[model samples]
Target: MAGRGEMPMRPARPGPPMQYRGPPPMARARVEPIDREKTCPLLLRVFTKVGGHHQNEEFAVRGKEPKDEVQIYTWKDATLRELTDLVKEVALAARKRNARLSFAFVYPDKHGRFVVKEVGSTFSYGHGRGDDAKSLAELGFQIGDYLSVAIY
Candidate 1:
């Protein structure tokens, strides 16, 4: 202790030097491209009637009626015509079966409302000679997109 008018001194405590750990270490996740090949083929659902009854091939029907088989198609960047032909090939009864399939490519309009457009004539769905053809990719179609197939 010091007397009046005198100053008392205290020992300084030492601490570890401060360390700067700039922006917590950053980590990156590895990303890989999708391998379209060697995976389960892409399948599109088509609706058709059997025996005068409206049926959905993807969904099984009740009450003893034969279940319309679901058609499977390979994934490809194809035109509407090619998709239609593929459906025809898978659906053997499309030509003779009681169900008449009116193929339509459906997509949401700018308003987000689904619009089903008919694709029958060569001019339909932007398919024609030369560069008029439109591929699914150009149409902005992505995986899991649904194409409505109307049957009468």
Candidate 2:
């Protein structure tokens, strides 16, 4: 029998663990890819250009001219992030306008129906952080008729 600390090396030694030559994995993937060209889901839900037509001033007084709504549908799978990004994008696009314009962060109701917050600026209507109706509603333009959400 082997005594304490004496003649205990009966088994042969094994080689050291192999070195991992491969590169370390990316740092937890990117936090979020910055897709400059990518538009979010909500952009599809845009339903702007509701009920208007290019007509002469003389024709408007007669009320005989047919009007059309440049309507759009609600983006079906608009995530909050996508919606917010789209709203901001639209607002930026409005830069060409002489006056500041409005956009809405339109969403659905509790009963699963779509609803528009107001026809105002995104600044005063949908602040995009949960509840910012005032900033959102401040939007002065309607994206679409209440019903004609341009289906993406």
Candidate 3:
């Protein structure tokens, strides 16, 4: 109440209005749906090659693999367009029609080495949509993993 100055008003800085949390919403792990006639079919073990992939130092030896093996019993919900149509029935160069497979996942790491790991790519006919619907337990595939395809 001074008669010649008027300078007194400072009290308004108390909490609530600074939000920007950012980083807590990535749960996603609800995969359950495999009962292909009571399940029981996992022997993937594929290894074809024609133009690329096949060099994690050639799986760094363990019985010298990479002679174009193909032994799929499949069913981890198998998809990559159903393993690219079971590797075009047996890889007649992936059945042409502008072939392009390219999928990997050799596995072994933890000092055992032999880690290919690609995980997706498809097209031997078309209309299969993205990584051909990805499966084999959604591409984390681990059961002696070893798929390696790559048939441009």
Candidate 3, residue 110: the lDDT equals 94
Instruction: Quote the lDDT for 68 in model 1.
Output: 52
* Top lDDT hit: 3
Model 1 pairs in collision: none
Reference-based TM-score of each model: 0.36, 0.25, 0.30
Residue 74 displacement (Å), model 3: 27
The C-alpha stretches of model 3 lying farther than 4 A from their native spots are 1-50, 58-97, 106-108, 117-121, 129-131, 135-137, 141-151
Model 1 per-residue lDDT tens digits across residues 68-102 = 53454655355556654555565555444343545
Alpha-carbon RMSD of each model: 15.3, 18.0, 15.2
User: What shift in Å separates residue 79 of candidate 3 from its native position after superposition?
Assistant: 10
Segments in model 2 whose C-alpha atoms lie over 4 Å from true places? 1-33, 36-43, 50-97, 118-152
Query: For model 3, how does the per-residue alpha-carbon lDDT over 82-129 read when each residue is reduced to its tens digit?
Result: 889888998798899888888999988899988898888888988565
Clashes of each: 0, 27, 0
* Error at 43, model 2, angstroms: 5.6
The residue-level lDDT of candidate 2 at 96 comes to 35
Candidate 2 Cα RMSD after full superposition onto the native fold (Å): 18.0
Whole-model lDDT values for every prediction: 0.48, 0.34, 0.84
Top model by TM-score, which number?
A: 1
